[model samples]
Target: MGDASRPRFMGAALAGEAGSSRPSLESGHHSYPSFDNNSSVYALNPEHGGTESRTGSQYFNYRDDPNDVPMQPLGDSRYLDEKRATYAAPRQRSRAKMILAGVAAGVIALIIIVVVAVYFGVVKKNDNDKSTNNDSASKPSGTSGSGGKGSSSNLVVTGGDGSKVTTDNGTTFTYQNSFGGYWYWDPNDPFNNGAKAQSWTPALNETFNWGVDKIYGVNLGGWLVTEPFIVPSLYEKYPKAVDEWTLSEAMAADTANGGLSQLEDHYKTFITEEDFAQIAGAGLNFVRIPLPYWAIETRGDEPYLAKVCWTYFLKAIRWARKYGIRINLDLHSLPGSQNEWNHSGRMNDVNFLNGPMGIANAQRSLDYIRIIAEFISQDQYKDVVVMFGITNEPEEAIFGLDNLQRYYLQAYNNVRLASGIGEGKGPMISYHDAFLPLTQWAGFMSGADRIMLDDHPYICFGGQSAAPISSYATTPCKTWGANMNTSMSAFGMTAAGEFSNAVTDCGKWLNGVGLGARYDGTFAGSTAVGDCDTWTNWPAWDDTMKSGIKQFALASMDALQNWFFWTWKIGNSTETGKVESPAWSYQLGLQNGWMPTDPRQAAGVCGNTAPWDPPLAPSATGGSGAGQIPASVSNSLHWPPTTISNVGGGATDLPTYTPTGAVPTLSAETFSSASGTGTINAGNGWANSKDTAGAMVAIATCSYLDPWVGQGIAPPSPLCSGGARRRDVPLPLITPPPSPS
Candidate 1:
């Protein structure tokens, strides 16, 4: 068996070795009687990833068999009605008896007071200051324009209706800074070895063309994603959290248990505007934002479950645009767990592909994509969002290729239609390989012009995790070089969607338990050997390793059309040290001087892949076209000479057309329970019972005093107090009810 301590690719031998039955991909659907229909809204016990206890030496797949929910037949109005009824309708206070009604009224009154106080004293007062700061922070970046460069002040915001408005009035921005300071594009530095006196514009900022530009990017992991291993401190603080799904549930419980204010504060501070500035400064031109389906909302649960994160998602998009960075919006998790991994927001289920529920779940997943596509299609974000990744790291071994392909086709059409592809303005659609052989997708989306494949090739997991650090770093480039050379031939345009230098599998820190160092004593045991900084040979060995790996990274840039490093940053509380930080963190790698300080280095590799092949033009068979040097136009200007270098040779030409499309205006509650119907049902079951008397009182108590609870403010005496005995009180007064008569 492979090292159980690392990530084992399940599609390879594990299914058969474990004697797990393979359900027919083209067969009848089975109803899962034992499945918990209410699991989506309620917290299940923490025994996810199955009952098989994990040993330290075990290679961890982080997948468990899905608990299949019974699927309702489509167009069955009765079943739909029943499901709708199951959604816990907010109980009307008037429906209760007079005694309960009076109590509810009091609770409502108290809630208003608290909200008024907080809104005025906290939210309102700070809102303006935060807004001002955010605007000022975002404004220092350049304006969007063509030519070697344009003044940030001169850029104008063109309205969707083609009306122009200058940003000087504090209306909108049109440009952001391009590469000019670093050695790659710097015209001033004496030590500069590369091209200067030129401008470089990102291909993503132009039209949606895969032919001329190769994608060079980085993943924004652990920012929106609450991965236990990546942000170990979060998990360590909550003992029951085995994964993101579990952690979310625990946080929900904490909020319900009178910790709402703390939860709100957490979301406010987790990932701020500064992170975006730093990402832009690092010279990475793109970011892959891995977000869960719940970032919008999952109607069946408490608000905290969804957590009002849509605002943050929008904030991230704006920030990316402000900094001249493109975004690849990735739906990392689906309604029903797409894969059994914790990153899927559920660890025990591949519900997306299981039995009858699979179709329903697939439809739900499509709804999320459509909504996001609609948002990106708007005038402001159309070009900024370069790729709309449908899903991330799905396991086809359980989901089945037929189902995956079917959903991809449906989803592709939906996105194109919603984003108005006919107008020549839509982002590229990216789909994950799902552990299947890449050859299977040869000419998969041939009819579609801007579809691509997403593959995650990591050295820190599976069999590679056990390999020596040098072999881990140097050997993969051979496969990458060969694969990148043929990417267009095999799949339209392929990219390494998620990858990192980590070469170890230490996860004990997630549980707040310390495991002995996996490498030399100075490095964190959880860090991969490839990223470790404590070599016995000291600085010389460090320099050699960095150089070798840097070359390898450049080789990868040459091989693959585009690549995003696995992560930008891990939580500070979770980072062991600069060198021993989460090995996948690109920021830590930069701090340690292992990563390139300039984005132009990627262009350098694009210009020539020496060890692999002399710069050969892409094959004529594929849609690969020689890059065009951008010509000066009214809105468009010439980018620096070093931005894109044509491999295989051709005349310099710039793509003139900038893709534009209409942003969708969706109805309210786009994914809310009230709007849910047809195949887009929220989930299988809802709250089956009405609110109990205790539940009603508790709800009132929470609605009024939960914030106070989080703020350490005790509710007045008996009723609002945690675990305090409730006194039988008459309506409208705090005095005890006639001694309970």
Candidate 2:
């Protein structure tokens, strides 16, 4: 009976009272359906956590043979033809509070009323300030590496394949920025007084009816950026850690650093399955996981980090499945300095796909995908997960388009031919942008059916064009985190990878939206620029955007795209507003992009208008196969909800658009006949049955969508024709993945 409210950071504090159904560590992410026949592919991430990070190449849990799909642990090997339903990660927990059980059978009904009141009171307190606060634009005055000051003692993390840690008892543990690893920071003002930690709740959003095709779909990063380690037993019981033991720093920190642990505390936890489950029930679908290649390939024959980290990963996956959420596997860092940092786990040059390490990494990525596909693809979740992304955000200089294309294409082929794919195989691919020219996307790689193009959009390059809510449907080009219209061809998710209101708005403009990329395409430095002569304040609603949320909601629903806001949360950064402008980018996320719950904030995004109730999200797809894109055509990927939908009616349901928290949910449709003009999926994004014929072109990347579709809460028109225009340059007549390869 808890009243609904606005979106928030991991509702870690919501764990006090919860449901009784104890979820399996694996079941914490998503509950899978029954599957008997299959081979290899151990469908769980825990086994990998145990093997990838602890054991070595020869240490997987599963075995060869498709028949082993259902029982396979996590290892390298193949299997033959086999059939099964599918598998999904279980639901992880959240931070929301729970209702007390049976106050009194006689007063049970009355207790329900009291529970509702209490829920609102707690939620209101958290949301009130959040709902209506900000006035002037405020710059971030952060805490710097001063946080990393040397402590009186050192904490050693051992056991569970180094999954164990020894804290200085309760001594002052200091973690400098260097401890976490080097990343980009403005030099002049390179220190602050604010570090951030997160309260991770497993994804429980209702996103079954849709998914992603282009990399623009919503996804959060930094998973492997830094690891947090704390009370293991608590996390061991976390519903999110279902089968595998994935590691995250956000869940293991204290409140001082905004609940963040020093970088050295790395991957430990004290969470419960109940905590993760609440998260799943709350509605945050999809967890963009960034794992270091070392967890599974460091010593090849002796992968040391897996036993623990990989195991955690499995636990997370299962919980996500139980909650019916999707997972986006991202190799955030590479063997060598993929982007000049320690995030990839080391600060060296690791040629992921073109060197000895490349082979190792490729095999690591491939084998991982193979295991997952073989094990879970046949189960009930076969159609839910989209693809296994090759790497996170890599520079074209290191991971060149041609080379990347070659490497990924090779990987894709391996996946297709590996077996256990049955008649329906999702896809395996990779993504990169900001470094390559947007105009040159067509010139990149293409071969796999799930060839997804990713780009990072930041506003550092230009001026901020102000427009009204209605203007969002047409004006404000599609470039990442700048002013935009929902219907414009330039505002799609895939067209403009990630966005952050981080630098630009501080907690200012982004009480809602995010930021990103450039004009000619290719990576440039951060898009941090000077702000207009406007006053900004604390983390309250930006005057313009607060009311604008409704407008933003309308546009995203119209398009249906998914996106990972720039960040989920950020650690303490001594350097604040240090960007030199015209080349700055703010990290998206309050701590990572979730904020505190406030009464007022909750009122606007929650209550009756909110869609977090049970049956909140229903299946929207209806087996007409998937939609299609023009054959042998290379479409120029860009931003804007309307633009993508118009150009390609392909996975129009793909979550290529951005996430708008307060919109109404959609339903699905079952097609009895393929002979109608336009179909109405009774609910969700299903192919409107009762259709006779109206063109069913198949988009090569079958997994992607219109970009807008995934972001929409309600059903949308595949074509919003708000601003259709002529192409300025020639587009690639790109071809789809080779049949079956």
lDDT of each: 0.45, 0.28
Best by TM-score: 1
- The stretch of ten residues in a row with the least summed lDDT in candidate 2 is 5-14
lDDT of 2 at 173: 20
Tens-digit lDDT string for candidate 2 (1-741): 011111111110011111111111111212222211111011111222212111222221111111111222222122122234475864433533322333344367656765454334422322342234221011122211211223111212111111222221343222221111111111111211011111121111111222221122234333334421111222232324211112233234334643323322334332222223323222333445565554433332321243244444555444344333456666564543243223443322333432222322343344444433333232222323444555655533333344444445444444444322222344334455424333345433322233444544332122122223233421111212121111111212233234333222222112111112211111122233333322122244354543343333322221223344344333222223311111011222112222321101222221122111121011112122221222342233221112211122332332221111111111111222112223311222111122111111222222222211111223234322434221211222333221111
lDDT of candidate model 2 versus the reference: 0.28
**Per-model TM against the reference:** 0.55, 0.39
On a 0 to 100 scale, what is the lDDT of residue 311 in model 2?
A: 42
Q: 644, model 1: CA deviation in Å?
A: 46
Deviating ranges (above 4 Å) for candidate 2? 1-220, 227-266, 270-283, 300-307, 337-342, 347-350, 353-386, 418-422, 426-451, 460-477, 480-497, 503-560, 571-741
TM-score attained by model 1: 0.55
